[model samples]
Target chain A: MANFLGLIQNENMKIYRRNSAKVFAAILIGLLLLGALIVKLNAPEHPTQDTHWKQSLQQQNTQYQQALTQMKDNDSYQNYYKSQIAINQYRIDHNIAPDRQMTLWSFVENATPIMILVISIFTIIVVANSIASEFNTGTVKLLMIRPISRTEILLSKYVSSLLFSLLCLVVLFLFSWLIGGLFFGFSGGEAHLSYINGAVHETSWVLATWQNYLLDAVKLIMMVTLAGVIAALFRNGGLAIGLTIFLMMGSNTILALISQYDWVKYVLFTNMDLNQYFNGQQTRNDMSLGFSLIVLAVYYVVFLGAGWLFYTKRDIKA
Target chain B: MGINTEPQKQPAVKLEHVTKKFGSKTVIDDLSFEIYGGEVFGFLGPNGAGKTTTIRMIVGLMRMTKGNIFIQGHSVKSEFKQAMRQVGAIVENPEMYKFLTGYQNLVHYARMIPGISKERIMEVVKLVDLEDRIHEKVKKYSLGMRQRLGVAQALLHHPSVLILDEPTNGLDPQGIHDLRNYLHELSRKEGVAVVVSSHLLSEMQLMCDRIGIIKKGKLIGVETVSDFMGEGEGKVRFTVDDGQSAAQIVKQKLSLDAASIESDAIELAIEHEKIPVVVDTLVVSQVKIYGVVSVTQSLEDRFLEVTGGKSVG
Candidate 1:
């Protein structure tokens, strides 16, 4: 285990020692601060809470119920309206506010999705070249001659790339929270209404925020793994990074087009969004939350397995 | 360099019928050889003769299609880590991370193996004579400096076997001479078995204690440097005022064949002993010999002779 950790350290040294990695870190922080500034500029000066919010939410739920009665069962927008009504009812039942507050935690949560995508892109760009760059520079010859096994070498690169992504995420989370607090006064952030399993429940804001970020990162994990496989197979960094980024940006449209078929549920992108089950936003009814998790797990194994097989079995001609 | 030491009984590296194939093409035929400790083994072959491939297999960068290699009595295929722990090799080029400082690159390799201290890293840096610029990035280094740094990295763990493939490529003349001396010292004093591969016979001639010549993916022969160069006869050149007269006088008086004749020189196939007799006869016949020099039969000449005049790539 100690031996393996040293390998990881060596791998991390190669990663963070590159000047581009420092530049990426600086840019990620700058973007987070800039995003908070933009929100600060756009926020309303004062927020008002309605005294009769429960009565208003009750009227909205009645309107939502009538709209649902007139809509088709498979209407894509049905889930959105259903979740909204349930969350509103929960708020009124618990006598909690509607959570339309301009606060630190709210801003942190809202910024997470975009920032996660940015961080994913940065991580992908770095990892795509991790294995292939060694071959390109002819350094793999020396690296492989070490007493460590090739599997361990490959694992170290994979883990280091993930660690880089995690570092970016933690930085974004903490910096966004601090920046949002400076702008929004860090109040009214305790209430977090969560819609789960066709019911609404009040959850802790910090836990909810972390869950939101992690769930949003599922696709990034899958795409990064795919990038690693491509890198191992082709030994070409540019091709791997380019193809994975294209697939990532185009995944939604691709899924929408094929989501009508039963097999589409098994497609990698379709199951990548584990949040679909939690957010009441799934496009297909064929896959349950357990089913998506299983599919994603299977794909993860396949991706990592393919990478291992190629990295270990194939002779390094370079 | 000091006197060449005799190779010890224990072999540090052994290849038994090792073969490598790429797709349907065989790159290395059934090759078998042993490099004993305290000796420098030279691998000589022409272009496309699988020198690089064999190095890769020995270093575990490439897999052999058949047979196996043993380093310090550990099978490379079955006990890869144990086998590799005894070896330090630069398979082809001594390519380092140009973005990293020389010291950082050494540290990067040091972390891969256990029991290497910071003092060891510094010691290696100093040994390679890169201590002055060890903190500078490798991108600023010369090719010779990078080669030295590679040697430093390979020596950090004190492995019993050191393999350098074309280690003299891009090196200055002084650098090559220094490396030759260093390799000799490593084999003689430290009892390390060194394997060096190159197509340049001149470099191999001075540096190698024993050589194995490979042609068309097959090893033709392996012999000590002295025994290999001691074959057949040597050429003697006669620089004279009249080359035609020198050739005529030498053929008539000494009965030695004048291999070729230039305007002011003549070359003769003669034994080392007959050189004085030829010089005496040339002088007696008033040939006016300006110079009589024996042209040593170089390894390049011997290589050509053994390979049947096939070109060296």
Candidate 2:
């Protein structure tokens, strides 16, 4: 409906109008360009010099085997080396290139987590402040007295925060692509060798990259939703942002500390890293992609429900 | 001006026994009142008297625990969208998005309601006389300018009822005068039922056609401005050649309390109907009265009397 679109537009205007938002965007883009420049300067001029697919695959396999022997007691390190050896062996057997060039796509693929992290931090701030600032500044009454329902207003705010996060992701992707292409040169093929089902498989580079981005977005979605809930419940932007960032930055450590507990697998943070599933890595031995998706779905619903219920039912006294 | 031109028309806003309770504490207790079209109704109350609470309920920002509010016949409880569509309110303060320009804030609000046009926005801007600085961000605006912009935003949709809570909280004399004239014109010309709550009794006395006084979550009185101030007997001050003799004559002839003699004037508290009798007695006694003036009680005095001397905030 036009009304809902108008609401979203209004919320977006409120977000983008702030000078801090503009400064944050500029900083993000600048950081990405700087990162690209650093990567370009550090890359070797001829990375694939005097190396064929068979030679390089043999070299990588030997290195991984050496590391695997040294870290045999470490399950994570052993699994990493095993997967690397399997993929290199497959590439050699199939006569596939080792993707030696540091292409733009490769840079983007490698920087996916960094991009997700930046966007998540930015989104946590945005979403947390979205509802809380209105109450803090006593502007919630202005929005509530309008003809639209409270749910509609809160939904628009949620949508606007997600849209901002999506915008950041898109900008980061495009900017990285452009900067990386200028520096590293666009020289990679569309095929990427990935280890899946205990074997190396040739997957479409674009599909894998997009899937990685999508998985990264899952974490962003959960974080932004939780921040929104905090903003609505606490009505304090500083507290919401502080608590969300603390939870977000400490989630991995917390997950690791509780990994031995069976119930830890059900924790939202443990399931938030959908990128593990993409890389054929299980966060927990019992955790599967289906189970993670289900956990995320439940958290998504609960977060959204709590945010909406508190916003709609709680009185706007301030 | 006539309060309501059409006596048979439906009330613009009707609150039926509205009650608001906050965790075992009743903020508004069974409050009921109606504001008809083409009248400026002043909501007067002391601090913690539930004026803002009642306004919040009427605007749908706060829910009533025991009653319903109707805006132009649409019940706020069941048909909030419809009820709210006919109402525009600024509760407590006109806190807008300070990061946004004045025009942008109005545009943002306009998007929520259907059928509001660019011309209407311009019209409201001009109505509030913010045409010159409407493009500037609200952070750069003065408090008075912000209040005017708030009024402009509230009037954009041409709602049937306009509710302003403490609208004149921070304003210069000129700004207050402008706002008072603007609200009076809005109610008289556009038939917009305006409900304004304020602790400024003098301003309310000048602006509101009728007033509703509340104290301790109760509606103590509601009446026309004149009737509200003229509820009890008024003081009759007789300026005469001899104040002492006139006071003695008023006390003896009118059977009233002893008149307070000050210089050449004798003041006596007497009923409105007894003014002529006192004048006749003074003339019969050849007291040579220079002037006889009846001084009605001010709204503040009457409000204090009605609310048991609790000061209005």
TM-score of chain A of 1: 0.93
Scored against the true structure, residue B245 in model 1 reaches a CA lDDT of: 85
The TM-scores, chain A only, for the candidates as listed are 0.93, 0.91
lDDT of each: 0.86, 0.85
lDDT per residue as tens, model 1, A17-79:
899888997888788788878877886667676788899999999998888787755535677
**Residue-wise C-alpha lDDT for candidate 2, range A1-318, written one tens digit per residue:** 899999999989988889979887888878778888787788787675555668867988899899978975555666677888887787777777756667778887877788778888898988888889999899888889888999899989999999998888788778877777887777755577777657777887777777887888998899889989998998998998899889999988887787777788789998888776556554455678889999999999999899999889987889
Best by lDDT: 1
- TM-score for each prediction? 0.91, 0.91
Predicted candidate 1 versus true structure: per-residue lDDT over B1-313, tens digit per residue: 2246465566789999999988899989999999988888999877887888888889888899998999999998999999999998887889999999999999889888999999999988887788899999999998899999988989999989999988888789988988999988898888889999877788998999999988888999989988889773477898999999888887887777798899999998877788889889988888888888877788998888887788885
Regions more than 4 Å wrong, model 1: A46-59, A70-76, B1-7, B237-268, B275-292, B304-313
lDDT of model 1 at residue B190?
A: 88
> How close is candidate 2 at the interface, in terms of C-alpha RMSD after superposing the true interface residues?
0.7
